[model samples]
Target: MLDARGLVIVFGLALGASACGGDDSSSGGGTGGASGSGGAVGGSGGGATGGTSGAGGGTGGASGSGGAGGGSGTGGSAGSGGAPCFDAKRLWFEDFETGDYSRWTSKTYDKNWNNGFCHDNGFSTAQANSPTHSHRSEITCADTQSHRGYGGLQFAGDSVVPAYTNQGSGIDAPNGVVNTYWSWLEAPYAFQNGKWFSFWTVNNDCGWKDNVITLGLEDTSNKLTPAHIKNTGGTVTFAPNAPGFPMGKWVRTTIYINYHEGVMVTWQDGTKVFEATFSRPDNDICQWHWGAYASGDNDDVVLYEDDNSIWKLGQKWTNFDVEPYFGVTQAVCSP
Candidate 1:
């Protein structure tokens, strides 16, 4: 079972070391103390550190969404309200409505990581249902479902000198804010029994949260199923999907993470698939990768993601792209 231990090691080994000459010594982007006021989003867990004060975008405007007050500061549990309000402001968005891969970044170009450039290809009937041009990602060479390839980009290599490898620049999330990633996604390929695909989310120091394993319990049907997990420290619980959850169709996936509140929520096509409130491996949530990850016979698998959006509550999310907009950085994993 790849638990938090494996993640700590992998992330530590890959990005924990001093990155030579990077913006920040850590694998993530430069950190500025978030300064904004979290509107009185009531929850008993009053730290209200919501990245608040003298700032550009944050402390977070987390309004009183959780029973007005339920948990401790920096950690929140489910309150009278099943969940917080969905009114968080949007941090970023992409519908491909423009029909161009603008701020969007991908690995399909890098060859070292299994034709990581396939996503760069023109629409493979990319949209299941879109009024405008859409794109899909196809990979035929990747055989493993373990660590991702960051689209053939390099992560923080083991360098003592602050290696300046820019993977998805400026995309890192600031501390103490409610950040969310939402997109319409579909896997058109037929389900391969036992084969798994995954994605990344902000958690345990804004590292990868494997959706494949955490999505569901073991089932005989071999389809996508998210698991239900609750916190050992807090009261928020996660609901897992059954072995027979729907697949092969476009589903809307929304992930919400509030580092200050220590809450994480996942929704599939509007249904809450998983939710958890956690506080461990201390540090604010940092970054996320838009990887339509797949495993086993990737040659035949294709993933469609469209209308991607980033939502930030209590503070507008930060942008991590460069001017003139050539491309963004991605954490290309070493093969």
Candidate 2:
């Protein structure tokens, strides 16, 4: 069944969408639907009571408790025994299930320079991490310009998700607040033979109008390596210690930006890829955006994105074991 996080545990049943279908972290893991009000994955009949302080775990073993039924459940806890508890709220999430870009604040394409190649952006059903639809962007050729043919979405500031400041202590500080983005990406064979495809970037629209942090795929000498752009406009490319970016399949990616501390971390399929300190200190994370951009050389490059989410990690420094609020089963616990 689909829990409050809108995640479906495909044991043998169907799924349900969230009330704020366009922009909420409704994807989570569990069997029985949540019980009290907001609904968390409970054990037997229902799970914990929905409020600031959870009432009781469900009847069974896999129950957890959190405010407004927002906690993820494990094999034990809440009413049963030792399940973990977490509280999180969604800043933005676009599963592309609506089959359009209606959820985004704005859309951008190839920066007024039409290369005459096939720079396209839309929805696709070919492959999706969620189930039905996903955002697809394809580029056909290389660009000599710095900002090449790119098609993407812009997530500006809104009421539910306001701007955050990066002026706290260093990494892992107690006053740290993290803003994380989770998404599934796939590129069949575009990242081959020294081609670079920019999947997402956090740009500063307020002061310097520069990219504070950027992540992309760089095929250096035919070896797949993740690339990042520093706030000072310098490029740092390194191969992952673990398995590199795989071709022809979807991979889970997580980008964590600490607003309290000027630190950024990246993970691919639960493995740490890289970590860096933001050069631009005391910056505001209000106008940052993400997209798919093709640079260097390109030949029939295609990228697919599904089940994208932005979350506010209040006390959690990293996204590890926070909750299964994105349709995937995560280790249940308190952070």
Cα error of candidate 1 at position 172, Å: 9.6
Tens-place lDDT digits, model 1, residues 274-326:
45555544433323334333333334434444434343343422321110000
Model number with the top lDDT: 2
**Candidate with maximal TM-score:** 2
The CA lDDT of each predicted structure is 0.28, 0.35
Model 1's lDDT to the true fold? 0.28
- What TM-score goes with each of the models? 0.47, 0.57
Model 2: lDDT of residue 288: 31
Local error of candidate 2 at residue 232 (angstroms): 3.5
